[model samples]
Target: MTSAAERPLLFLDVDGPLIPFGTSSGHRHAAASDSSASLDQGNPLLERLDPGIGPRLMALGCHLVWASTWMDDANEAVAPRIGLPRLPVVEWPDLCADAGPRGLHWKTRHLVEWASRRPFIWVDDEISAMDRIWVAAQHPAPSLLHHVDPTKGLLDDDFSALAGWLRAVAPSRVTSTGD
Candidate 1:
């Protein structure tokens, strides 16, 4: 069996995948009660995080890492609300230095570096074909640049897709025999 460190990584995004945006989704909230929301933090949309998401993500069996612009704040403000422990945060390098091909999302290059050739799944709202093409050339291992709709955060379908891909890629290690 591969060590947990050798398992694929899941690079999570905050604004889109975790906290849905846009007024049309019906998830947009002005504020949440202090209990549900992150302690004393002021991002009203923090309430949009589905508390059930943490367990769902944990079930995927990949090493979860925060790749959002929220940086370490995701560990402090988001993790607790979703019932996740502190996860590794991808420290972004200079924005100008890591820019990839034009039209690539700003995070594309940095995430590829952070994965360091291990298979990885990048869950974010801004994934583009350009980013996929670049990673294909730059990253030697398997990768999925899964784009989540910002208007609606991760739904059941999203979880299904993530699990399917993870299982397919690392069946022996990632497959959980039970729900």
Candidate 2:
């Protein structure tokens, strides 16, 4: 097994990615200050994941970093409420922009700046139609930064799809189903 230093980074986001909401497995409901978004909840995919996920992700050299708006509020109460391992968070400070209703812009701008020169996958339901296209156009491997859409919280198809993607993109993070 590889050490933590060897892992590629999985930039994790909260809200739409982790929490199950909405109607489709890839669809979710994300509430913002003034507006809400529909996105994928990858949480169900990672929750109680088989050890293979962590090890495989680590084997492929993956480091999990929290990049959600909940960063500041993560460990305080939300972390436990959300069912994560303690309160792992990102080192990079946020640019701190209010996503409000147009959170897609916030994610894109922040990702562009935060990811800087590193590779990252942003899991959020708020990703706008444009951001997906924009990221694809800019990144070396557009797939490096993935977007898991849990239209509805923890749907079977979404879970299956994410498992495949994780194994495909970061073979190390791949594990058998917890579902």
Candidate 3:
């Protein structure tokens, strides 16, 4: 098995992949009612998070990092609810008028920089074709820019895709089904 340091990094986002926004009101209500005691009561969006996701993510055996606008807030607010331990947060550069090529996501460049040529996976809702093309050219190592549907969040199929890619890139490191 590959050591943790050599394992691929899994850059995770919050707003879409974890807390799905397009869920039905009834589902939202049920989630809110079933909220964990440790969860922050003020942010209703936190309720949408499935506590089961953390283990599924951890099972992938990648180094998880927070790559969301939530930043440290993802550690403070979302981690506990989902059973994830404190993870490294990607510090974003201040947004300037010229972030990147037109149609490229603002976070795309930074995530690549943070990966520092290591194989990595970026799970976000905002990835575009331009971002994929740019990363392909700039990042020498294997990378997957998987876009999560904000409406559905990280569904079973998403996990399957992530696992499949990880297995192809680093077979021994992918330890479980991530189901």
Itemize residue pairs with steric clashes in candidate 1: none
Off by over 4 Å in 2: 1-6, 20-62, 86-104, 141-151, 177-179
lDDT of 1 by residue, 39-113 (tens): 465666776788988888887888999998777878888999898999999998887684767899988888888
Q: Return whichever of 1 and 2 wins on lDDT.
A: 1
Show how many residue pairs clash in every candidate, following the order shown.
0, 23, 0
lDDT of candidate 2 over 1-179, digit per residue (tens): 22223334566665555543444444433343222121123333324222333333233334456777656444443344444454356544444746434435555655655555455556566656777766667664424445555444324454455556656655665555455
Lowest lDDT 10-mer window, candidate 3? Answer: 28-37
Q: After superposition, which runs of candidate 1 have C-alpha atoms over 4 Å from their true positions?
A: 1-5, 24-41, 175-179
- Tens-digit lDDT string for candidate 3 (71-120): 78789889998999999999999878467789989998889999998999
| Highest lDDT against the true fold, candidate | 3
Choose 1 or 3, whichever is better by TM-score: 3
lDDT of 2 at 87: 39
- Can you give the lDDT of residue 120 in candidate 3? 95
lDDT of 2 at 70: 57
lDDT scores of the candidates, listed in order: 0.81, 0.49, 0.86
Sort all candidates by TM-score, best to worst: 3, 1, 2
- Cα RMSD to the true fold for all candidates: 4.3, 7.9, 4.6
